[model samples]
Target: MSMDINEVPSVDPKEEPHAAPPRGNLRKYDPLDMESASFSTHHGQAAKATDWMTILQLAFQSIGVVYGDIGTSPLYVYSSTFTDGIKHKDDILGVLSLILYTITLLPLIKYVFIVLRANDNGDGGTFALYSLICRYAKVGMLPSQQAEDAEVSNYQLDLPNNRFRRASRVKSTLENSKFAKYLLLFITLLGTSMVIGDGVLTPCISVLSAVGGITQATSAMTEGRVVWVSVGILICLFVVQRFGTDKVGYSFAPIITIWFLFIGGIGIFNFVNYDPSVAKAFNPKYIIDYFRRNKKDAWISLGGIVLAITGTEAMFADLGHFNVRSIQISMCTVTFPSIILAYMGQASYLRTHMEDVGETFYKSIPGPLYWPMFVVAVMAAIIASQAMISGTFAIIQQSLSLGCFPLVKIVHTSPKHEGQVYIPEINYLLMLACVAVTVGFRTTQKIGNAYGIAVVFVMTLTSALLVLIMILIWKTHIALIIGYVIIFCSVELLYLSSVLYKFVDGGYLPLAFAAILMVVMYVWNYVYRKKYTYELDNKVSPHKLKEIADNLNFHRIPGIALFYSELVQGIPPIFKHYVANVPSLHSVLVFVSIKSLPISKVPQDERFLFCRVEPRELAVFRCVVRYGYKDFHERDSFQEILVDRLKEFIREEQWISPPTISSNGDVNGNAMDNGEVTNEEEEIRRKEIVGREIELVETEYNAGVVHLLGENEVVASQGSNIGKRILIDYAFNFLRRNLRQRDEVFDIPHKRLLKVGMTYEL
Candidate 1:
């Protein structure tokens, strides 16, 4: 059973207060002690037993949340591949083989079997991989981390010894290098940014491709009309994001399920009726023969061929929302077979009716099911967009919590689901970008290329991160790691090279988006580091805090004030800003610092680290509140919980005070018969002393609580270089100013808040 250190035994308050111990005698609080910390706020519960019904229910639910994006890929895979137009009979079998292998190898084998299990606790993504690597190594860029953080419940891992010299050297090298840390962060952010790019292009292409089916159904439906319709649908899809995914998951799962069933049913019909020879494409020879027949075109067509597994990353990225089993079960049983059959069925149709290559997906749809398929296709496209949008929100949320991205407003749309977040700024921005792609490109082929670029690049990054995980985290053998890297890298790089080849033809879009977001992330992280460094270097000493406490002119007001700090220890310079300007502070001042740890979830009991500053009569305390990326801070009751925990800390500290040994093994302010206080009588005396302190705190508890935050801004000094000036003054500052109200992020009430305005120059 876990210990709650705050559950100190009650003591009688009728006795006298103990005399204060000498400055050097008291036991300084150790925040690193895993046994003593306790918190009132509950983040998440532990996993429960997984019965068959629960697994089946979650598996069905995973269809909507996890597989939407990948399931919709069939709408455009064949169409995109034949953009130059499918001219040869062998090309049909070849393209189908490429699609089958790409889907079979990457998503089904690499992701479902390997990468899904690599999740940080229940979380997964590029960030999760990064988090996993960070836990096993000292490569984390966050400054406030301690050695004890590694031993936390979720982040804990046993390391291989120095006997494995190569691995040891590699780990040491990665930990020691500043460049390596930043590079890893840059790469992770790039992957996340590409997912944002996916958010933009996936909707455009999916919707456009789905709506294009109308062109086949009727002569009146023009490409222009289809584009407009797609844009409208994209608008609707993004607007409803405020409602949250959990609210709509039930509805979306059925549509996607029925859509998959319809496509699979049609696939069986076509394979049986049109060309059973399409089954031969499942063999590796056709993929080789297609390349052998048309080498250059085959290489370039890989840009198109990769559309088969476009949104497969979403399956892995959204693993936090849906577990690995449900995703794997849904994909293997339904999504995977349905999509494979859909492509094979398309291939079968293409062998005989070669003229309909561009419209093969729609044309191949059995005539009776065409209209129903189009409607389901549209719904599936919308569902696909919804999944990517939710994923974008999650990635941004993680980035924000990790301090890599500028602050943005995050709304938890569902009370029950912690991960179901919606970002208005990101949503509207994505909508505009999606609309622009549809308006400008107006064709699925160009948009498909852009989408392919985003998808393949994210895959490549995931593969790169996985190699490090296989080495450091999993501690796999060197031979196995090398083989994993080579195989995955070769395939991903092939697709990556194909996408890069089309840079001039719509592929530049995702690249541009990635570059822009990378710059934003890099700049924000740069400013964050500089600001953190300043706080660390310029912190107020314990002597200075004592002096502040001793001075009478700095009036102590009647309420409890929670002063927010960026530093884990010592006083932040922002406190200096406030003290210099203001004549008074609260009667009880609590220095509060919130840190995001590399772990997925910091257990509630271990969340807050409370330490009492010297001269307890002055009522000053410091708290370090830690959270993982997935942990959501409940805004409404956080202050109340924090105050209650503070009360608990004070009581616990008071109770532990006299019994705690001083230097040379003597108990502070107590007589030691033989280097220790005598048993029963001394214990009762200590209890009486603690009860007195509790009463004092109870008197101050009647006072209200106020929150203090720093309104910090970054500026480039005049003497700085033009490059620095442009980055800090223009780019980073603009994003900081316009993104969100940083003060609002804490959800502190305006009336009870104190904002100490400050500026820093680089």
Candidate 2:
């Protein structure tokens, strides 16, 4: 039943699973009969589940979650370039070069290369990147790197007695790493802000712009109703947040899937109609020609030109779910080539048919009904905002689990769906912000003012962070990256300049909102870190396991008890709470502490450590679970296995007395052997009433007994008859303090102050 200290367990697939039986019901324990804890039936190559198919699904889902913001760029890009064509043409060419470069370079190349690689798993986004980087601070990355000290593990394991070798070895990585914690905090704050900004901005811009497109198509829809319609659409969008993506997400994937095809089809039709030379939009020349023909409006054009890159952040955000290879394949095969053809096709259509203008060019397609397209486009935008909001919620969910946010209610949408998250408070906050944006802005024309600033701010920060990560992580030189980022930042700055000019025009609000959000994220993290992370840390005893093993007579649980620890202790201190509190002595199991090793090698066998706490079935045990980024999940982990084993051990042990009910509601408490209330204690309580934790002399609420049993304390709170109390008090105090001038009896500070003022002291 005990593991040998000299032998190392294999982490290999061939190793059989070790099962711990429950003390009571054997059925409760998982029959770990498998040779190894491998879950490869659904993964890896033998499963026949190609990464490409998953990648494609992930890519299409990204479009559902991400495409609208980027997809709508067609509304303004060609227009921006067209209007700019009337001005200085030289800078236009440069700007055009910049646009092509941003599209091709950022979304296509750099995002696919550097940013997506940082995904925690299939959840790529700013928050994912934040998590990836913050692991240093999260796992005490910096302290582990530099410090001699070790943080302790909070959880205890239920493995049968054995000297844990592999577990101890792996659990040594983040012993005292403070850098991981700090870096995680910093990155989380940044990511939370960007996510929140995107959440609010997405619905406002996406739906409003689609409405703009729709209104242009249909003349009956009035301008004043635009705000109302936009607000309604936003409310509907926020309402769907609770349901999770599995419900409405399927519809969007199909719609967006069709939308892309429609875009391709339209491009083909227009290409056949216009100067086939327009096929050169992909050549990066027409984008050049627009600027060449006119340059005076380069800054303004650049402002609108940035819209095309709206989904650029989304591309990076989704790097986790799909392989980089698949995203590139989609871009090359479906998204990119199609996008170029469409834009060129649209531009070509405009070139020849300027005089023969239809009400909306989007509507002029030959065979189909255009109104439905507008509606679907609106749905796409709603989905876009939904994706942003969902991403925000997901980030906050992870952030909260990491102890970075105030506990907001998080209701998971599906047991099987990891990404199906819903946070009501966030949804409402974003909804309110979005609806306000709709009401205040009125149209996409005004909404655009609130748009570009977010991209510039986030992208600027992203580029800056990338440079840092690349320099620090990849050990690449930062100078060249700094120069390139600076150039892009400067370009972004000029774009922001145009946006700022539109502040009075409606842009200042989102900037203000984003700033407030950033501050909130920082404040939330700062307050929690300062107030809580260290609260339990110092309270726990460091030298606990050896002491527990030495003190056999010490009271403990009958079976294994696993308490999740933030601390990295050999024997978690929570077990000490039991020794000090419980009268029974049984066995103890501490996981010791978990840590990752420098080597990325997967061990031949998985169980890290096995150690004896005491003797036989009454013994204490320990295990240390190690995991990597790809290894994160709610289920399927060494820690979860430990929980299962602990439960099993507890059930199998008969030392644990069955829950015996008292006449009064009580569980764990200091009591007499017979469990009878002592009248002598009642007398002592009346005598000792003068002393209490919180003194309640008299209150609006009933002054019930603030009970104090030795280890436990609670207020027996009762409501006061506020009406009768206030009425009588007000009359009595008025008569005594006001009429009779007995100010002390009045007991109202302001009234007493007024009397003093009336006394006219020099």
Q: Residue 268 error for model 1, in Å?
A: 0.5
Q: Summarize candidate 2's per-residue lDDT along 126-191 as a digit string, tens digits.
A: 555554343322242221121111111111112312354332332233224555445544554665
Q: Whole-model lDDT, candidate 2?
A: 0.49
Which candidate leads the pack in lDDT?
1
- Model 1 stretches with alpha carbons more than 4 Å out: 1-46, 654-685
lDDT of 1 by residue, 615-719 (tens): 555677788788887788768888777777777776555434444433344335443556454555565665665666566556665777778887777788779
After best superposition, candidate 2 residue 618: deviation in angstroms? 9.8
Count clashes in each candidate, considering only residues at least 3 apart in sequence or on different chains.
0, 70
| Root-mean-square deviation (CA) per prediction | 5.7, 16.7
Error of 1 at 357 (Å): 0.5
**Could you tell me every candidate's TM-score relative to the true structure?**
0.91, 0.62
Alpha carbon RMSD to native, model 2:
16.7
lDDT scores of the candidates, listed in order:
0.78, 0.49
Residue 111 lDDT, candidate 2, scale 0-100: 67
